[model samples]
Target: MAASGDGISKSDQLDSSPSSPSPASDCAFSSSQSSYMSNAPDPRPDIPSPLENGSMKHHVNGDSGVNGINGQMKATKVGSRSWVGIYESFLMKNASQIASVESTLQHLTYLFPAKFKDAEIASEVVYSALGILGLYHDTILARALSSCPSSAKYQPSLHTRYTRHFTTRNSAYRTIAYMLVVIQKTELLNEIMSRRHGGQRGQHTAILGIESIKATCRLALLRISGTRTLVTPPIPERDIDPNVLDQDGPITHAEAAEEDGDYWMMPRTGQKMPQLKGETDVTRFLMKKVLLPDDVAPSPKLIRPLTTADGRIKEILYILRPLVYALLALLAARLRASKRFKGHYEKVVINWMPWVVGFALEYVCRDGIIDSLSAEGGIRAALTKITGLEKRELEKRSNSMWWWTLRGQFYDSITKPILDKMIKKAENIPLLNLVGLYITDYQYLAETYHFSTSTL
Candidate 1:
């Protein structure tokens, strides 16, 4: 048990292995060393073996040899699987259905972060996003574009952000081709034109935000117009009768049959060919000027003089006739309102004058030709004479049993007889003097503000 000079006890020296050591003592020493090594960190720090404390092995700042190898492997596996299924599903859908799938993919793409695993997959994403906003189809494109102006007003920043991201001219030709194939091409072109005219917001931004959008729309418009998609169908030939005489020209038997055949051929033919016969005074004047006299034969030698006279008369009637009638009517209305004409004269001015004037106007407008005028014209004959209204119309009025029952006989006997008597009385009155009085009274009234006169 005594220590030797080399600082080894005699017992330790005897226990040391020298050529052959005792196996039991060596085994006991190795077992004690193994027990001490159990609490130390592992030599392989790259693997994610749990720490002695049972905590996850962190990748950084380790006292050990390495870190994060297992974490890197896990991330690689996840990233590899990311977007793989999305890419496969996206490719299987058609363009119309792609929009719905694209929305989900976009959300996934945002939620699950990963680099595009393949170029084809990236392009498919781009294509799907474009389709979601209807960039690929014309009908949907129109709806999208039409709604853009409104969206630009509210959430303008967000609107601009997405607008610039989506719209590209690479599919311009394809878009135009699709729109042309639709039967409603004209309506679609009109919608685009109206959108252009309606104006767009942010169109002039320095970023060319809406301006670039308008340019794309203009390109589509140009494509449509250039292809003549807006061209209307050709009008079919129509049968125009050269010998038609007057506003109420009689239809010949053969002409009527032909018209019936045409109407039978095309049900909507009458809707296309509108008739405006004598609906206006200008039309009436033109008709009269163009129509030939039935009593006189058309002579080429007299054509020049007749045309000049007809034009002169038409101009005079178009200008002066309406003015003269307006003036007379105004004078009659004023006279009816005057204090002197309130009682007995009120009836004559209000009721009688209008009836007489109306009848006279109808006669002049309808049968005022020189040949129709004769010296033997009396009040009774004038009342009985045919004018614009036919006898059939008068008979129809007389034979209206329901109207007679509803309105009573006062309109038929009293009102009609009085109106006829007034017409007869008004026939003898000189129209020249009445016109002169109107002019004189008009002048006197105009100067009344300057001087008091007994002209009233």
Candidate 2:
């Protein structure tokens, strides 16, 4: 029993010992378990390690930090520019105004009918004044744009586009100025004369005389103010063989005497033409003693632009048409004023047909509709192929003719009628109603007389 008690006490003391070999083994096992948990790859790979997360964040922050530094450098450089550099951008260039101010005002006339309505004299004065101001404006703006370095290369093309041939260039201005004379003969003239003279007229042709002088002065100004002539396209100095001139140089004095001023002897309307400046002597001198096969060559070879210059023959109607209308109007007025004539005949005949004829003549003459009647084709088609005009360019010109529905007589005859019906329908539509109702002023304008009852 004593031996068993001693063994039990030894086991109890060993269990209660502070530094036992069992405890040390247990400590080693616990440390190994903790190391295994830390070093082993986790089954949940979805949860990233704190070290991996920190590495990814550092990489992203590094990229963002570089970008921010670059942007700040760029901003500092731009912000350093001086105010003088900013001002020089706009200040160095010439200030300019628009060239189409007159056309714009005319188009806008429908917006203010009351100002231009029955007051013919007032309207004429206003339109003429604005037209003059616009001419000066165009002149100044042209001076400005042409002086610019960027636009200098395109100056010639710009001039060609904006300027017309010599004959037709001033057609509109000339017409307006001349109308200033006859415009007084219409309602405005009659009203003024009647108010002062009280129908007891004693041959008051002095007003006509004054207007004629004024018209002459206005024409002189137009001649002085605008470009007088265009530079005629460079003509091939000689188309004939070199030795061909060795054949003949006949005296053209007789023929020249008979010819008025058709200096270039171009294809013309046979009407006496004034000597326009900058013409080339293309008389080929093929009228030699011994004629070559080339001399018989009758190609319709003329300057490209001059081919259409003859179209100015019809444009002369600009000057003649208005004068004719004015004279006819004066006759109609006289007939109305006659004690023998009275009611219906006067109203229908006096101002009615004159306006229609004049308006039609204006478009027909100016827009080359008359020339289209005898357009150059077949034999002349080869000759008419203007330089620099390609087949595609010509096709573009042909296609653009479809846009003529918006201009000239086509507008009066075709476009306006269709637009009238469409306008009413458009006015009924919700969003589109604005286009037809208040936006366009010409939709309801009278076709016969321009600006309602105004003569011009």
- Candidate number of the best TM-score: 2
Mark the 10 consecutive residues where model 1 has the least summed lDDT.
229-238
Backbone clashes in each candidate structure, one number apiece? 0, 0
- Could you tell me every candidate's TM-score relative to the true structure? 0.17, 0.33
lDDT of 1 by residue, 280-329 (tens): 63353233334222112211111111123332343223223223333454
Residue pairs with clashing backbones, model 2: none
Each candidate: what lDDT? 0.31, 0.38
Model 1 CA deviation exceeding 4 Å by range:
1-322, 365-456
How many clashes (backbone atoms < 3 Å, residues ≥3 apart in a chain or on different chains) does model 1 have?
0
lDDT of 2 by residue, 1-456 (tens): 112221122111211113322221222122223333445454445644444556446654566655664455444443444343233222222122132334577555434533444544455446556655544433333333323322311212212332222223456643543354334334333434443454423223433343344435444433432311111111111111211111122324433544654444446754433343322322322121233222222221111222344444443454355455555555655766775556776566554655567556655554332243236664345434432222222333345445434433446567787887887789878978866754344343333222233322
lDDT of 1 at 333: 47
